[model samples]
Target: MSYTLDRGDLADLARGAALLGTGGGGDPYIGRLLVDQALRHGPGTITVLDPDDLRDDDFVIPTAQMGAPTVMVEKIPRGDEAVAALRALEDHLGRRADATMPIECGGINSMIPLLVAARTGLPVVDADGMGRAFPELQMETFSVYGVPGSPLAVGGENGETVIIDTGADNRRMEWLARGIAVRLGGVAHIAEYAMSGADVRRTAVPRTLGLGLRIGRALRAARENHRDPVEALADTMAGTLYDKVRVLFRGKVVDVERRTEAGFARGHATIAAFDGPRTLELTFQNEHLVARAGGEVRCVVPDLICVLEADTGEPITTEGLRYGQRAVVVGISTPDLMRSPEALGVFGPRAFGLDMEFQPVEDLVPL
Candidate 1:
């Protein structure tokens, strides 16, 4: 089934995307506003194409904002960066893009592609490279599946653009893009992981946008009815894309340590239990990478570590964490694709420099 995304969906999409962000992917608020404003002035509807309907040879490209999420809040986009990057890559590819997809299905990255689709009249693919957001470009499923990361296009708010052709080394592409983004005022729009429709069907996390929409809708309904939004979220997520969804900790934030380092928001947050000495510690590099309680690892990367407001259940990005904030920490299992050995190698606890081995959230905390 296909449906057009209009302004009505923005709030739910933003809220749901933020939850999927798992404490990173930047704030979706600005992206939602950008999309809302764009729709009012330009296209009234952005078409969403189902991944199963794509033809084998159709050319698909992923678009996203790159660099520090904190930087993006201060340096708002000029509303042309995504399209600029998309067009630049199309020119380099020597063919018209058949569709667009999100590099990740969280926060601003998820909405940017929809905004581009509205402007370019290209259908936005339903799938995304990461089921959740990752701090680095090389961590995408496309990169893990041996997809070429370049010829890549980077566009700046000030009309500066750069195209890179790095063959198949996505790590090199990420390195180059990060340097370029820092020079371009800490944020830039990027297009990468250009692939045929078949490759996308085989590698991309499927139906994530639709999943986000459902999650968002449920959250909204829960809040409107004065229900426990966190429990609503857990019930909504269980046995779906995430095999396990449970509140890992409920407390008040005791400490938050965050800084923009190497063009990424890097930090840790401590949440003290409401009535005990126990505390939950989250280490992050943009997204929460590890969660520990009482000196034991409760959750690790490849699985999701999400921080939410204890009452309203609003997701709190790493950049948004603050001392004394009442919070609930939730752990979610990654999709099957992300639990593979290759996927774990790239996003697991070890990949984040934590000494422990990777364990599924379900294994660590049985549902």
Candidate 2:
């Protein structure tokens, strides 16, 4: 069934998506603002559709943002970049998109599909290529499951556009797209991995937009009810596809070393426990990739590593982490869909150049 999303729902959806982004999808604040702009541009309400309802030949497009997310904090999109990219892709294919969906389920990328859907009057699919956010282009279930990442269309903030039909392996497409994205000003809105409905149903992660919305609702409800918001988050994750949540660490941000390089926010951070000398270290390439506590590997990709405000359980993006802020780091395992050997080879720890085993967050953290 399709449903209308109210203005009231944006906050929760963005909040949930930020948490799930694992620190790398672009800022949720900007994402929400973009959605607000999109709403103002055309439709006041977003219509969401189930993936199962899609017909075999329906044209489905996935929308996203690519480049150093840190750069977006200052260089806000012009609000029409993604829509322009979608139109460019449609023109290249000589077919209009029947529906659109997120390429990722994190931060701005999570909301990009809705923005396109709102402007185009197409229903957004309740699915995404990655169940959560990943920094790089090839690290999606769609790629792992045999989907080409082109003919991809990338659009700049000022209407500059490029139509990419690499149609090669996703890795080659990633480099080609990343290089183009960097040239477009370090942040570009994109439409890629155009798929037929049958292919999307087979390759995309199902119902993740709904999952993110639920996460937002759960956290907001818990906070309003004076319950522990982190606890509420755990309870919500308990019944989801990406179960096995762990309070990885609780501390104050003591250090963050970051730089905008290779069109990505590459960095590391250290959090010191307030009550003890113990510390947790995080290393990320756009998104949190590893969590080490006292020199031990507590969690690694493709599991999610999230830093949330201690009291409110609100997710803090990489740029938002600052000294002395109280924070809690949580880890959530990726679903089996992203854990198979084939999937692991694409996005697992080793894929990130980390020399370690791909252990589920549940095993690494222990119940």
Each candidate: what lDDT? 0.89, 0.88
lDDT of 1 by residue, 51-86 (tens): 998999999989999989888778899989989998
The residue-by-residue lDDT of candidate 2 on 172-255, one tens digit each, is: 888888998889879998999899999988998888888899999988888788888878988888867887889899999999
**Candidate no. 1 TM-score:** 0.98
- TM-score (C-alpha) between model 2 and the true structure: 0.98
After superposing all C-alphas onto the true structure, candidate 2 shows an RMSD in angstroms of 1.1
lDDT of 1 at 197: 95
- What is candidate 1's local distance difference test score? 0.89
Residue pairs with clashing backbones, model 1: none
